[model samples]
Target chain A: MKVLVPIKRAVDYNVRVRVKNDGSGVELNGVKMSVNPFDEIANEEALRLKEKGVVTEVVVATIGVAKAEDQLRSELARGADRAIHVVADQDIQPLQAARILKKLVEDEGIDLVLMGKQAIDDDANQTGQMLATLLGWPQATFASKVEIEGQTARVDREIDAGIETLEVDLPAVITADLRLNEPRFIKLPDIMKAKRKPLDKRELGDFDIDVPTLEVTETRPPSGREPGRMVKDVDELIATLKDKGLV
Target chain B: MSKILIVAETLSGELHPTTAKAVACAQAIGGDIHVAVFGSGDQGPAQAAAEIEGVTEVLYVQHDENNAARAATLAPQVVALAAEGYSHLLAANTTTGKDLMPRVAALLGVPQVTDIMAVHGPRDFDRPIYAGNAITRVQAPGDFVLVGTVRTASFGAAGGGNSAAVSDKAVDAELPSHTRLVEQKTGGGDRPDLQTASRVVSGGRALGSSENFDIIFKLADALGAGAGASRAAVDAGYVPNDMQVGQTGKIIAPDLYIACGISGAIQHLAGIKDAGTIVAINNDENAPIFEIADLGLVGDLFEVVPQLTEKLG
Candidate 1:
């Protein structure tokens, strides 16, 4: 079985993103970038499947500018067998990204596509589901636990109500939630080996997708909360709560 | 005028509160609003949807396989309905909406805007990014149908007054057979739902063990509040994932929120920023939770929680 993991380069989770002074968008200048945490978890799941001999190869793919190759190379070092970079000069919307991924899935003959539930940058949790619709494949999203057994994948999803177990046929898309798996650290030796692994590049025009449908008009920081006062003790806290009629 | 289509969400034959909130968002877009309800048999939820203010009609779609909340079966039906000259498609930014809306958008060959907190026009919306740290205003092309998910926390539920017409609609799309729901394990409790509760009490990793989490629950129960847990508590196995409140978890806006033993992480703070009044109780005086807390108390949770619970009782 061949597993494809779609990774994304996003603002580091810990960095405090600020809106531009001109209200254009979030400031990206000199901020740290890393693979989205959920995508890293997806790559980790694929690597585990490969290590267990259930998957023959694990391929990591990303759609971004030339700098995104660094993200793909990092995935390769972590355990992916190869990498595919779909070069796009500007940011592509989720639908276009899914369409391009659909084309790549067919071209690569991928048996399964695992990806992050959402990118922390845009917080748009749409790619995996959109890709599943475009390919007419079943999707098991927000997966906490995934098990592959003879053409079927049983996924336990963390939902609002509780855990929902779903079984989907092979050649499906699975989106990883936070609890899926802790990604492995890249070793120095593995990094050296990844430098020699196969890395393929393709252009966005190769897929013949529609133009983006959405455009960002502006961005601004959320209104700041008022500074709060500290109470000296539990009694003071209760008194403050009473004064505010919150108790 | 734009025609808005809202996908009604329900559980056990009753409309979810988020559905009404979605209607409020649709009303703000200044459209002739119609709601589509998909389920197996009961028409209770559809009838409820028809009564929401500003809704013009309710289209109830009944299918044999649509007994449960399966996005795979529902999205196709929604997509088929969306083809009937609807200019906009909307649903609540909830688990079900998140599961289904993207598929509907893809099938319609459009991009979806998720978690819209405000509507400036039919095509312009404001959504939070980076866990509510920044708000981005976006606009979709007017030529294509706009698809979006409403942030329920930001909107008030549409009131019930006049009843719109309800009509039965046929399901015209082929449903997928590969995805099957095996079983669902729901956390059983009588407490108010965390997302809609007026007051909430949350515990963190400082609770130490799952057994020790009873203190948090006792406090919540005494206060008649919902029980929530920080991601740290959920990750540490001190609570179930459904009880988690944070950016990656459920975003809640309650009137009162009590943070017990929670060292405020930014992600955790994002969930409760909309809460009216925040109270933090932690032994560490310098915990970041105090930075946003309206009332901060420095004390051991093991001692403070029990005392708080007793005082409330």
Candidate 2:
């Protein structure tokens, strides 16, 4: 089985995000960048599937500018056999991203698509399901565990009340949740080997992927988290809550 | 103008609270509000959705045993039912809703705006981004016909003004059969789920160990609240990832959120911002958590927790 894993590059989880002075988007002045956290889980799971012989090849895919190639190399270093880079700066949203990816999947004859539930930068949590829709394939999101047997995938998902088990056939999309697996750090030898792995890049125009602007938008600082007075004790806390009618 | 559709989801043949929230948002958009449902069980949630303040008609699209699971198989089924005339489609931004709605948006080839706190003007929304550190006003693409909304604590939950009429319009969903559900082995905990509970008590790495994390559990028990954790607590191997509440983690909006030992980061705050009242307890005097706290305490969690526990004890 061929496994296609989608990865995204965004600001490091540790760095604080600030609104751009010009207000177009986030201010990326000087911040660390890394693969979106949940994507790491998907990558690790895809690699494990290959190791267990459940899958034969793992193809890592991403949509971004040229700079995102570094993250693609990192994914290859982590264990993907090859990479597909859809190069474009279309300011694409998750739906458009899914459209572009659906074409890639059909072109590559991908049997399964593994992705993070959401990107930390936008936190939209839209791509996997969106791609599943575009492809008319079954999808499972926020999956903590995925077990494959024959042409079906049995997954345990982390929901609000209790865990729900879902079953889907092959040619499905599964988004990784946090407990899926712990991501592995790239060892030095593997890093050296990854440098030699070939990365193939294709422009969005090359594939004739049409992306239209979805929305006119501006970003602003998150609202309603103002500072409050510190309470001295539980009594004060209770009193304040009562005064605020929050208890 | 065509009406907006709301997918009222259910579990155990009952209406989940988020369904009511979705109904309310449908009402807020005000027009002909249509409620849709699936599953083989009773129409409890659909009936409930119809009764919501603004939902006009409840449309049931339940299939046979072939698609009993609420897995991604429900995507095509949902989009097909929603294929009729509708100006926009609204779904909760919860786990199941997230899995299904994006696929619906993809099917429609429209722009899907997620995690929307508010729908400002028609075809426009205000949603949080950058881990809730910023708000983006997005004008959706004209070609697509669906828009999804998020639970904004009060926005959707409070739009309960409509009484609905239940209708059974059988649909040929032809949902693909799902894999069989064998078993669900879950952790043993008396606490309610952090994402759905009205109140939550969270701990940070400052709790030191799992045993110490129990303090928050006891407090949560006393308050009948759910237990949550910061990424620090989860990354330190103090708790499971399901309990981690943040941007990358579960995004929750409880009525009351208590932070013990946590220094609120932007990501953490994003999940808890819609919380009605926030109380923070941390040793650092200048922890960022205090900025968002409706109430705060500066002290060591290890010492403070035991005292608070004993006092309640």
Candidate 3:
């Protein structure tokens, strides 16, 4: 079976994001960009499936500007066999992204699509579910474990209450959550080899889809909490709690 | 005036607290708010939803195949109801809401805004990005319906003095059958839920082992607070993932949060930033958690926790 993994270029998870002074969006000048952490986990899962001999090919796709190709190359160095880059100059919403991915799934005849549950930048957590709905396919979101048997895949998901397991047929969508697996580091030799891999480029207008329907009016830093004071000992701690009526 | 439809969330035939919080967000938008409750032979949640102060009407939809927890079956029903002249759709930013609302937005051919912290107007909202590091103000197009999920931690629950009418609404959409809930394994405990708990005490990897977590639980029990764990502790098998508090885990905003032995990674800080009062107790004074802590104690958790519990008792 062919496995398709959708990755995105986002701000490095460790960077403390600051809003632009103009209130347009987060400042991206000279900021370090990398594959979204959750999407990295998804790619790692797909590579593991390939190693287990369950998947015939692993293809990674991204929808962004030319800078996104750098992210695709990094995934290729990590283990993806090929890359598909859909060029978009402006930011696209989850609905448009899902529609574009749906077209790719049909065009590539993909049997499985693995992706992140949410991107750290937008935090929308919508693409996987939206694509599943548009395709009328089964979805196993926030998957912690996945096991394949014949045509059915058994997935364990991390939910608020506890773990819930579901069985979905082939041609399904699975969104990876944390704890799925720790992504492996790319070695220098692998990076050199990745430069020789195949990379395909497509345009956003190639697919017939509606434009994004949301607009950003402004952005600013969240209000900060007051600086806290230090207490001398346990006695002082109790006093502070009592003083605030928090005890 | 804009008409808003809220999808009510329920657990075990009872309305979840976030449902009322979603109502509070809708009320802020100044609209004729209606709530839709989908379940199987359970009118209790619908009745509970009607009692929320700002809710004008409650539409209870029942069917044999309707399981409110399953997004595949519920999204279609929500889409059908949204077509009846409702200009805005909202739900709590809980697991159910995060899973269901996006599908509704996709079916309606609109973009969804998730984790909305502030509603400035009918088409304007503020949502957190990069795990609450920044807030972005967004506006939806007036020509299309606006769909979003309210951040329950930021909004207080609507008051309960008013009574609204409840009506039965029929399901006309073709629900998807590709997904089904085989079994759910919920955590068995009598402790307060971490997400809505008024007070919480969380432990980190410094607790050593799963056996050492008892001290953390003991202190929480003494204070009648919920017990939480950092992602470091959960990944180390010191606790279950469900108890983890961080960007990938549950986001909580309790009245008081006590961090025991936690080094306070940025992701963990993101989860508790909304907390009213934060207290940090770690062996290392240089731990990042001290920066934001309202009260900092530079001591070993193993020694401080027992003494604190004794003092509280």
Candidate 4:
């Protein structure tokens, strides 16, 4: 079985995102970029599957600008067999991303598509399930534990209620949650090896996906919270809570 | 006027309260709101959905294949219902809605506005991005059916008073068999639901271990509050993922929120920003949680929590 892992170049999780002064969008100048944390978990899951001999090959793909090749190379260093970069300079929404991925899945003859549940940037949590819908395949989102058995995979999904287990046939789409696996750090030697690996480049226009227009009219910081006062001890805290009728 | 269709979230015949919050958003959008209850072996959830104040009708779609509420089967049914000339489709941004709504948008060939925090016009709304640090006002094209998920934390649940008409709607959509529910394991049994609880007491990594998490639960039980945990506590294996309260976990807007030993990360703050009055009980006086907390106590949770719980009792 072959697995295709789709990743995105997003703002580093540690960076504080700020809206631009003009209210157009977030300021990305000189901001640190990394593979989305959830996507890294997806890559880790695929690598573990390959190590277990359940997967024959692992492919990592992304849709971004020229600078995104760095992210692709980073994934290759982490044990992806190859990489695909569909070069799109402009920002793509979830629908277009899913359509492009659908094309890639067909062209690669992929048996499984594993990706992040949500990019920390847009936080849409859509593409994986959308791709599954377009392909008429089963989807298991927020997967914490995944085990492959013959032609089926058992996935433990984290939902609002609790962990729900599901069995989906092969050629399915699975979105990785935070607890899926902690990604491994890349070594210097592996980085050198990844430099020589095959990295194929394609353009967004190659997929012939009809993109829709969603306009961002403005961006702003959240409303300010009130300044707080502190109490010296538990007694004072209880007094304050009772005064506010919160206790 | 926009005609809205809300996909009611249900599991094992219980109508989730998140559905009522989505109804509140639909009411704000100003439409004839019809909620579709799928996967219910009986009509109990549908009847509950009909009682939401702004709901105009309830459509009960009962089928054996929908017993699990799998997205692969529900999306096609929702799309078929949207084809009935409805202009908008909405659901609450819980796990079920987050997993299900996008597929419905993909099948309808429309872009989705997720976690709608505010509504401006029929096609314009505000939603949070970058984990609620930045708010973006987005406008969808008027030509397509608008699909969105409501930020349940930002809106109150619609009151239950009006009795809406309930009808059985049969969809001709084909259901898939590739996905099957194996089982489910739920935690925090008999406790108030964290998402809808009026008061919540959450612990952090400072709790040390799963056994140490008992103090937080005991306090919660004493106050009749829900028990939650910060991502750090959940990551430290002190609690299950379902108890996590953060950007990646459950975003809640309880009336009173107590943080024990939690040094508020920005992501955790995002989940409780809408909370009424925030209280922080951390040994570290300079912890970031104190920045947003309405009342702060600088003391060890081990000592402060039990003392507070005893006083409350």
Colliding residue pairs in candidate 3: none
Candidate 1 Cα misplacement greater than 4 A, ranges: none
Tens-digit per-residue lDDT, A1-247, candidate 1? 9889999999999899988999988898899999999999999999999888899999999999899888899999998999999999887889989989999999999999999999999999999999999899999999999999999999999888778999999889999999999999999999899999999999887987775578898889998778887777667777777788878
| lDDT (tens digit, per residue) of candidate 2 on B153-247 | 54636445566677777766665554445555445476775656888889998899988888888888877888999989988888876688887
Docking level for model 1:
high
Q: What is the TM-score of chain B alone in each candidate?
A: 0.94, 0.86, 0.96, 0.98
What are the candidates' C-alpha RMSDs? 1.5, 3.0, 1.5, 1.1
- Model 1 DockQ (Cα-based): 0.80
Per-prediction TM-score to the true structure, in the order listed: 0.97, 0.90, 0.97, 0.98
Question: Regarding lDDT, does 1 or 3 come out ahead?
Answer: 1
Evaluation by DockQ, superior candidate among 2 and 3: 3
Chain A agreement with the truth for model 2, given as TM-score? 0.93
* DockQ score of each predicted structure, in the order shown: 0.80, 0.55, 0.75, 0.83
Task: Write the residue-wise lDDT of candidate 1 on B1-313 in tens digits.
Answer: 9899999988656787789889999989987999999889999999989889999999999998888768899998998998899999999988889999999998888899999999999999999999999999999866788889998778878899869999999978999899999998877488887777889999999999999999999999998999999999999998899999989888888889999999999999998998888989999999999998877888899998898888767
Could you give candidate 4's per-residue lDDT for residues B233-264 as a string of tens digits? Answer: 99999999999999989999999999999999
The better-scoring model by DockQ among 3 and 4 is 4
Candidate structures ordered by DockQ, highest first: 4, 1, 3, 2
Predicted model with the maximum TM-score: 4
Error of 3 at B80 (Å): 1.4
